[model samples]
Structure formats: structure tokens, C-alpha cells
Target: MVSITSTASLANALRKTIVDTQNQMSKAQVEVSTGRVADLGLALGGGTAQDVSLGVRSADLSSITNSNAVIAARLSTTDTSLETIATTAQNFLETLVGAQSGAGSDAQAIQDNAVSGLKSLIGALDTSIGGVYLFGGVSTSTSPIADYFSDPPSASKDALDQAFVSAFGVTQSDDAVGSITQSQMQSYLEGGFSDLFSASGWTTSWSSASDRATSNRISLSQIADTSVSANDSAFRGIAAAYAMVADSGVTKLGSDAYNEVLRTATTTLSSAIGDLTRLRASVGVMQTNVSNANDSLTAQQNALASQIGALENVDPYEASTRLNNLTTQLETSYTLTGKIQQLTLTKYI
Candidate 1:
């Protein structure tokens, strides 16, 4: 009981076979040229889920890497600003020591240098980069310190002026100012002068910058604090030293009162230098954390990329060989279809 197949049915079946082989050849050629699978789902089949997961993970890691890069840049700027401040404090100390040692007898000249140094230190504390204040803590949009030389005079200057007037009841030029004792001057520094550097004084005199420091997510689980604020002890110490020298007035430079002020300033400046050095070391640790996180992310990204490549990437040589085989199969199918079509029922009878 052999069932005879219809010629039209056989022809239709051959045509479908030819179409399927042509599609395979086309896909192989594309893979050969692009070196990547045209369809991840089709190429990876059941393993597509793993490929998708890797893709998402890679994207997350890349974003973290970029964020860390920005943090690194900000930390670098902060480090530079702190270094500048430290250097300024060191130089001011040298100037103060030189004056106290009486190496140069021109009191007026020493006063001028002190004034200049104070202005420079203020400028450094107020440093900004890319429209963001490095020492402003979380208040990146505003300068952290006011210019001491502004036309109207900053609140810090006005406060010092009042303190001087109250202390001696006369200006620095009065001979009575020369009679002020060292202990009295020290009292002013530890009391009023020190007050000017206090948090309350800063709020009144300095710009209203935040006391909260900036931080960054350097890793998946870690957030690193990356900035030192202008409210830090080192900054306060330097500012107090400079303010004492600058606000004490020119007439008082050669007096016993001025020498006592200089001595206090030198001690404060020396302490500030040590504080800044320690702060810089802390910033260095932050820098290292960021760098290490960057490296770790990069390594993870590379590993994920390799996994995706294994699932989606095509071997060019293998694709080329497969394409040639499909091409031969397609040509043979066409030849056989032609031969079968020629064998009509009439020609066979």
C-alpha cells in the first residue's frame, strides 16, 4: 500500500527547503562580516538570560567608575588648595620669625609684609574651581571667606577694630597704645582674637558656607568623605594669625604691643602648619581609595565584557566557513529543484 506523492507537493517542499537554506547562508554572511551574532536570543538560546544580566551589571559598574572619576578630580582640587594654604602659613611664619629676630629693623616694612601675607591666606581659603568652592564644605556655590581688603571692610576687620578701640580706648598711633602690656595683648588674642576664629564668629563675619563636608560613593558599599572644610582648625589658626597682624595698624608695628601680637601669631601659624600637613595626609588616603575603586571597577567591567563576548561574539573564520557550506547546499538544492521540475508527467510517460 504505497501512497504516491503529488508533484506539486514535492515542488512546494523543495522550495521551502531552498528558502530555509538561503536564510541560513544570509545569517552566516552577516556574522562573518560583523563578527557578532545578529540576535543574542537566537544565538545564545537558553543562555540569553546570563548575557542580559551581565549587560546590566556592566552598565552599573561603568556609571560608578564615571562618578568616582569626578570625585577624584574634586579631591585633587581640594588637595591643591590645602597645599597652597599650608605654604602660605609657612611663609608667614618665616616672615614673623625674621621680624622678631630683628634681622631687618624697618618695622613699617615688616607690617606691610604681614598685611600682604594675610590677604594671600584669605584668598587661598576662598579658592574656587569650576564654579565650586573647594573649601566651602557642602556650600560649593559660594566663596567661603570674604576679602579682608574689600572697600567697606569685612565683618572680621570691623570686629577687630572695635576690639582694639575697646582695649586701649585709643588708636594705635596714641603713645598710650605703646604702654599696653604683653599680658593684656595676650588676653586680647586668647579672648577676642580667638573669638573671631570661633564658629560663631565665622558665621557672623565669613560667608555663610556649609559646615558639612562633601562625600562620594567610591564603591558599591562604601562612601568616602572627600573634602576638608574652611571651618577646620588649621584654617582658623591661620586666619587668626593674619588678622592680628593686619588689623593691629601701622603705628603699632614697632611697639611692645605689636611684638606680643607677632609672637602669638607665630605660635598659631606654626600649629596651623602641622594641622594642614595632617589634613593633607588624610586627603591622600581618600585619593588612594578613589584610585583603587576605579581600578576595581575597571577590572569587573572587563570581566563582564569578556563574558558577553563569549555569548554574543562570532568567530569570523568559523562564520566564513559555515557561510561557504550553506552556499554549496543552497546551490545543490536549486539544481535538484530544477531537475525535478523538468520531470513532468507527460515527459516521464
Candidate 2:
């Protein structure tokens, strides 16, 4: 036995054992450090397929959650714009009520405030993000609201001028406008002036928004309305209230005609205030839905991640213990190999 187990042969055997122990130590160290199996395919076997599937689902859920964050931001901005429009309308409504007495000091103030309100409305409706117009509905590329009082005479201003002249056969600033009767002014307001803010009219001049808003898939089985348009009736009513008061010859009208304009505009504004409130509420609901969907999606993602971890992860303590054992074994093999190589028949004799 001693002859057969020669110095060279015994050393070779220890060398092989050392190499195997080193390989095992390397793998164990990796598993301990990573908290996951170093060879998932080999460790999990047929279960690797399920691990891959779970990983894909978890990744998809995470992607959707990220996407919903963007959607939530857009909705938050939309809600803010809607609130601004509603507040503008409410302030204008209060101003209109205060000026109903038609005081001299109040007249210019009313016109000035109407001008400011129209500007506010236009600015809010024209709100954009990332080159996409939020109020453009699905027509995100275009500005939704036109500048009604543009100096060069926007399409809306030009259209208003034509409608006013056609209805009364006189320009708004003409002295003849002062001679206009209340009934005549009322008819004009109800007819042509009203038409100027109608859906078709607004589309032709004041707005380029589509009737249908943009929608996005928020989850695998759900979608959300991601935008609102300037063409909605609430926006139309608000614009009309401002236009009739600001542009429809208020500065040139007789007392009766002027009061008639105020009465009509105040009524429209009051109703529009309610509508604008409801519009904000609707957007709020969308915000809530997005939040809930994201919360649910995140929870699902965490659950899927846990399942994936169970399949791929290893016990770090167990791996660490195995690593220590292999290290000791490797060291012992090196020592044994060195000692065995030094053994010689001549030295023993």
C-alpha cells in the first residue's frame, strides 16, 4: 500500500481534492454574497421556466407603475388648470354681479376684468406639457384655445366682427350701436352672438380641440381618460360669458341694452360656474382612479417579486457556512499535499 501510494500519486490526489474544494468554495462564496443561487438554471431545474415568467410579469408591472406615475402627473396638471378656470369664472361671476348696478366706475372695471378673464381662460385652455396641449383632447399637437382678442385680429375676433355686423348691420364701436334697442340687442345675443360660441363656431375659430379626449391604458385590463378639451360645454359657456360682456358692444350700448347684456351674461356665468365645478370634480375622480390603480399595481409587483425571490434566492447563512467549510477543506488539502509530497522512501529509511 505504501509503495502504491507514492509521493507523486498522493500529492496528485490531494491536488485534485484541493481543486474541487476551491471550485465549491467559489460557488458558495458567490451565493453567500449575492443572496441568490449562483447557478439558477442548475439549482432550480425545470422551475427556471416559472422563475422567468414571474420575472417578466414583475418587470411589466413595474413598467406600468412607472407609466402611471407620468399619467398621474398629467392628471394633476389637468386638475390644476381646471381649478384655475373655475376660479376665474367664479371671480368673473362675482364681478358681474357687483357691476349689475351698472355704476360708472364699475363699467370700465367690468370690461377690464372680462378682458383679463378671457386671457386667463385662453391661457389655461392652451396649457401644455412636453409639447402636448392638455386641453387639445386627442389633438395634442395643436393649441386648443385661440387668442380671442389678438391685436392683428385673430380668427375668433374676425368671426365675431362679422357676426356682430351681420346681426345689427353696424360695427360694435359705431355710434349707431348706442341707439340700439334692448330687444334688438337681446335677439342678437340669443341668435348670432350665441352662434359665435357654439360648438361648430368655437371649433371654426376659438378652438382646435377634438371632442374626444385622449385615453391611455393604465393597467393590463384598464384604461383612463387622460385629457379634457377646451371644446367642452363648460368652457364654451365660460368663454361666451366673457365674450358677450367684453366684445359685444357693451361700451357702446344704451342703458337697457347694457343691462340686458349683463343679465344674460350673468345667467350664463352662473350656470357655467356650476358646470366648471363639475368638470373639476370629474378630473379629481380621474386622479383618484389613477392613484388607486397605481397602488394596486405596485402591490401586485411586490408580490410577484417575492415569489421570484423565493424561487431564485438562497439562504445566505447556509451558503456562508458551506463556504467556510470548503475554505478549511481547501487549506487542509494544500497542507496535506505539501506534506505528502515531502514523504520519501530514502528519508524514511
lDDT of each: 0.80, 0.86
Off by over 4 Å in 2: 1-26, 102-105, 330-349
lDDT of 2: 0.86
Reference-based TM-score of each model: 0.81, 0.88
Query: For candidate 2, which ten residues in a row score worst on lDDT?
Result: 100-109
* Weakest lDDT window of 10 consecutive positions for candidate 1: 246-255
1-349 per-residue lDDT for model 1 (tens digits): 9999877788889899999998888788789888889777887889999999999989888888988878888888778877777777787788889878986636667667678877777777677777888788888898888887788977777777777778768766676666777788878778866887888787688646677888878777788887878888778788788777766664554367678887888898899888889889989999999999888898888999999888889988889989999889988989888987887879757
TM-score of candidate 2 to 2 decimals: 0.88
Task: Tell me the spans in candidate 1 whose CA falls farther than 4 Å from its real position.
Answer: 1-34, 170-179, 322-349
Error of 1 at 117 (Å): 2.4
Task: Tell how far residue 63 is off in model 1, in angstroms.
Answer: 1.2
